[model samples]
Target: MAFSTPRVRAVRHALTAGLLAVAAGLSGMAQAQSSTPIKLLVGFPAGAGTDAIARMLGEKLKDELGTPIVVENRAGAGGQIAAQALKAAPADGHTLFLTHDHSISILPQVVKNPGFNPSNDFVPVAGFATFANVLAVSGATPAKTIDEYVKWVKTQRDGKDTIGVPAPGSIPEFLVKMIGDKYKLDLQAAPYRGSAPMTADMLGNQISAGIASVPDFIENHKAGKVRIVAVIGAKRQPLLPTIPTFSELGFPNLDDYPYYGVFAPVGTPQPVIDRFGTALQKVLAMPDIKQKLTTLGLNVAYEPQGQFAGRVRTYTQSWERIIQASGFVPK
Candidate 1:
């Protein structure tokens, strides 16, 4: 137990060096986690609803994660482009795709190859909101409800009554056919590139009515330019309580609401996914964030990772059955 002073000093020096090395390692890990800016990808154009939501979430998430957040717009093939980009991005927790059910659940059933299967290629980080498609007409139309709109269509002596939908083979487009079958009307479904153009035509009276998300028509409906006759979901939206739901209107088959969720590519570390999910849950719970999404006609609902992934699976299966029943052939 007797040691020279120099030997004791050498032992102290070695212990100090090991502690410094450990500290340096810890510092590097922290720096790596905080230095990189997370890239939040949106599969729609800049002004689209999905893009707007993504930017809003990104703004809040940046503060929560203590890192810069960049929203990248890929914008094509009904969100297939952005989904594919996320699949190819690094699995370092630095990239995510914010999208609605169309890209994750519906597109896979309708497109021959969406480049990535949502359930297979991606892991759900969190579910932020849910929305319902609405059946709305221009203010010029004398229809106060779906029943009235159907009756009014019968009275029109015009060539044919057309209902604009955001895109072909989308839920809105398919609902038009479902409505026609239910009412025995010969209404035509006109597919527009997106809700913006569809809304434009609806505002101009070029189209008798339109089928789009409630947010797509909320502003115009409030402005007295368009009237939302019916919504597709189990219950009336809180933002538009006056508008009845498909179930309330007796169209029970159309009562399905699609969700908006954040997803990371498969093979990402579990810690990263969990961290992002936690941050997203916090972001969604923020009062202002909830208000913004609520005003946009979206229900601010948050589902954690496991629950969100399960929801994606259930939704995909449900959409598969619906799309099959609708006789939609993949393009």
Candidate 2:
């Protein structure tokens, strides 16, 4: 059925107006995204290791993404605060969370309700590095090796067998329990607000030992203030070549390493994820940045979205089995 000439003209004009309006709306959205600063959330205090990494990445990412990057710290409950914040943010790619494995992979399984589900609330942007955790004995202790440390615990402290952990229900705390079970000692985990105080107590001999990331103890270990007896990884770490891995020492199941990655709110457009991830890939590839991160005890390896997601799944599953085997009911 042919319309009148006036009706046809009216339809053509309406279609043109609709197309122009849609184009204008898209252009406005593009302009807003280009001008808006991206907020990078970290669930740790300023000056913390995770905070440091976030700042470093933010510093370089601004140049690559062509927009200012702002790091926001929401310190509490072992990254639960920041994870919740990320969950609550709009899924418009303006907000991201930069964290290690604990927040995304472990916390939810341990906490009864952490207020955020990584798989449901966030999308993996990119993974920049992997790191190992170590068992470091305070300088006050005479033990330099894992065996010697066990002996010291069994003999030196008549009744005290406590290891300081950065946070309660953390991986280090679980490791403390595992070590106790293995050695048949009454080891207790003394939780601290963060690694700084935990290391201070270790330095002051208030705690016989502590378990934390390699970056947490590397400087002190190099200064002879603490002795790293064991690390958790498949093989020896390059930074501390002489330190034996738990796997090398006897525990083959403790070979998985934790990772550091960036995540955006779920439902972020694919172009946004791809752009941010591509920028991250370039940032991680810089020789100077790689050197700096390696110096901080990180094994720099850039994995894009798919590989990073797989890494997160594998690491999460490994720890899930370990946690379940430990008979730890989430609380």
lDDT, candidate 1, equals 0.84
**Candidates' TM-scores?**
0.88, 0.91
- Model 2 lDDT tens row, 94-123: 899999999999999999999989999999
* CA lDDT, candidate 1, residue 318: 72
Clashing pairs in 2: none
Q: Rate the local accuracy (lDDT) of all candidates.
A: 0.84, 0.90
Error of 2 at 251 (Å): 1.4
